[model samples]
Target: MEVSYKEEVSVGALVILGLVAFTLGMFWLTGRSIVSKGIGVDVVFKDVSGLKEGDPVRVSGVTKGRVARVHLDKVGKVIVTIQVSSDVRPHADASAAVASADFLGAKYVAYNPGAKDEPLAQGTPIPGVAEEQFADIASRAASNASQLIENVNRGLNPGQLAADLHNTLVVTQRGMKALSEASNGPMVQQTTQTLKTVQNVMARIDSVLGTRDAAASGRRLDTLTANLGQLSAHLAAATKSLNELLTTMNKGEGTLGRMATDTMLYKNLNATLAALSSLLTDLKERPGRYLTVKVF
Candidate 1:
C-alpha cells in the first residue's frame, strides 16, 4: 500500500502538533521549563554565594522559573538573569535576594512581588541582597583594629612630642617679645610725631580759614557766601539806579537831565537873565533925570 502525498503532509503536521502538546504537558507536570517564553529580568548582586545557572527562581517562595545566566558585570558585580513566568510582574518596591533552597547548600533567587497597586517595575536591573558573611567581616575588623593599635603604640614618642610643645612655646614667647620691642621702637615714636604734626597743620589750616570755632556759631564759608550775596544784590540795585538815571538824562526828563540835554530850556534861561540885566541898567541911568526936577 502506497500513501498519497496529501496524507503524508497531514501525518507530518499531526506529528509536529503532537510533539508540541506532549512537550507542553511534560513541562506542566514536571514543573520545568525548557525555553523561556516569558519575561527576562536582570538582577544584580554583590555576591551570588554559589548561585549558578538552572537554579530555580521563586516569587515569594513559590517557584516561577529558573535562572537563565550568571555573569560578572562591568563593575565587578554579579548579574543574574532569571526567566520568570509572564504573570509574575514585580512592583516598584520589589526586591530579590540570594536565598538558600535547602540545607544541602543549593542557592536560588528569592523574588518578592510588592504592592500590586504600585507601578510596575519592569526593565532595568533589580539589585539583589547577597548574604554577606558578617562573622568573617567582624573578625577581620577586629584584627585590623588590633593591628592599628599596635602600630600607634610603636610609632608614639612622648619625649619628641614634649620637645615639640616646648619649641612652639619658645617661638611664641620670642614673637611676643619682638612685638613689644617694635611698639616701643624709635620708628613707632617717629610715626606718632608725624601724626601729631599733621594734626597741628590741620588745626592751623582751620584757624586760618576762620572755621576753627565756626561750629559754635555757623560755618565761616556759609557766612561769607551770604555776605557776598547781599553785596551782589546791593551792587545790582546801584547798577539799576544808575541805568535809570542815564536813561532819564538821555530822554531830558528830570531836573539835571533837562539842564544837561534840553537845548530849548537853556535858551529860555539865558534870555530871562539878559532881560533882568537890561532893566537894571535902564533904572540906574534914568533915576537922576527924574530926581532934579523933583528937588527944585
Candidate 2:
C-alpha cells in the first residue's frame, strides 16, 4: 500500500511537471521565453507606434535579440529596452529603428551596426529612429480627416458664408459703378483729347525725324558743331590776347595805360580843362566890349 501511494504521488508530480513544461514551451514558441538572457540596451524613440515587448530584434535582417520592455520616459519619449544576445557584438555607434513585420501591423526593432571595431557596452542607451508605419500613418490621416470634417460641420455656417459673399459682391458692384461713372465723365473725354493731341504731336515729330531727313539733319548738326568748335577756339585766343593787353596796361607800358595809372597827369589835365572853361565863359560874356574896341 505504501509503494502504491508513492507511485501515485510520483505520477501526479510528473503530470504537473509536464503541464508546466508544456506551458513554458507554449510561451517560448510564442516568443515569450522565460530563460532569455542577454545584455539590455536602452533605446529612446519619439514614437514606437506598433512596437511591443517580445518583438524580435534583428541585426542586418537576422534575428539576434528581442525587445525586453517598453515604457515612456520623463520627457514622454518611448523608451524601449532591447535584449541583445551575448554572441552578437553591436557597435557603440549602432542605431536602432522600428519596422513593420507584416501588413498586419506587427513591429520589430532593426539594428544597424556601426563601423566601429569595439562593441557597445551593456546597458548603454542607444538612439532609436522611429520609422513611420504605413498603417499608422493612414489611420492617423483618416482620423484627422474625419476630425476636420466634424470641425467644419460644427464651425461653418452656410447662411453667414452666403451673406458675406453677398456683401462682397455689393461692395464690388458699387466700386464698379463708381469706376464706370468716372470713366464716362467729361474729365475722361478731356484726357482722351489730350492724349490724342500728344499722339499727333509725337507723329509730327516722328515725321520730322524720318530716315531721309535724319541723315540730312545729322550732317547739318555736325557742321554746326564744327563751327561752334572753331568759334570756341577763336574766343579762347581773343580772351588770351585781352588778358595780355590788360596785363601790359596794368604795368603802365602804353600811353593809355600811363594816363590811366598816373594820378599827377590826371590832376594836370583837370587844371588845364578848368582854365580853358573859364576863358571860354569870359569870352562869351564880354564879347561886345572886346569887339567894339577892335572895330574902333
Candidate 3:
C-alpha cells in the first residue's frame, strides 16, 4: 500500500509539471508577454497583406515588439495593435509598414522611428502603409503577359506573310520559265550560230595575221620604205641643180642672162631688123627687073 501510494503521487506530479511546461511553451510561441510592461500603439493600414496577431513588430530590422491584435476600424481599414517594449522609446511620428516575412504569406510590421527627441505616448495611432505583395506583383506580371500576347497577335499576321511569300515564288517561277523558253527559240538559235561563225572568222584572221603572213608583210613594207627614200634623195639633188642654174642666169654669166641684161646689144639688134624690113620693101616693087637680069 505504501509503494502504490508513492507511485501514484509521482505520476500526478509528473502530469502537473507537463501541463505547466505546455502552458509556458504555448504562451511563448503565441508572443504573449509573461510580464505586461509593454506599451500598446495603434497602427492603421489600408491593407495588411496577411499580417496577423502575434507577428513581430520590428524597429530598424530588430524585433522590439509584437502585433497584439488585428481588426478593422469604423471606416473599413485594417488596424493592427502593436505592443512595444517599454525600453523602446519611439517618437510621436513613428510609422508602420507591412512586409513579407517568408515565401508563405507570413508578414510583420516594420517601424520607422521618426527623428524626434520626444517618445510616443501609449495608445497613439501610428500610420501604416501598404507594402507591395508578391501576389499583386504576380498578378501584374500576368496582366502584362496577356497584353504582350495581344500585341503580338495584332502586329504579326503569319498567314499574310506566307501568302506574300507564295506570290513572290510564283512570280519567280514564271520569270524563270520565260527565260528558258526564250533561250530555246529560233531567233536565239540563229543569233548563237551567227556569233559562232563570226568567232571562227575572227580566229582565222588572227592566226593569219599572227603567224602565217606576218614575215612576208614586214618584208614588203621594208622594200616600199627603201624605194620611197631613194625617190626623196633624187628629188632633193634635182632641186639643188635647178637652183644653181637659176643663180648663174640671174648673174648675166650665160646667153640668156646677156640678152636679158645688156642695153647696147638690144639697140644694135633693133637697127639690123629695121634695115632688113626696108630692103625687103624695095625688092618687092622692082621684082621684074631684078628677075630678068638674073635669068640672062
Arranged by TM-score with the best first, the candidates are: 3, 2, 1
Q: Model 2 Cα displacement at 178 (Å)? A: 33
Candidate 1: regions farther than 4 A off: 1-32, 133-296
Off by over 4 Å in 3: 1-18, 117-122, 175-296
The residue-by-residue lDDT of candidate 3 on 109-168, one tens digit each, is 898867788877756777899789787899999999999999998788789888889867
Model 1 pairs in collision: none
lDDT of 3 at 37: 55
lDDT of 2 by residue, 134-191 (tens): 9668999999999999899778878888888986775455445444645744445555
Order the candidate numbers by lDDT, best to worst. Answer: 2, 3, 1
For all predicted structures, in order, the TM-scores are: 0.35, 0.42, 0.53
Candidate 2, residue 67: Cα displacement in angstroms equals 1.6
Q: Residue 213 of candidate 1: its Cα lDDT?
A: 65
Give the best candidate by lDDT.
2
Q: Lowest-scoring 10 consecutive residues by lDDT in candidate 3?
A: 254-263
- Candidate lDDT values, in order: 0.73, 0.75, 0.74
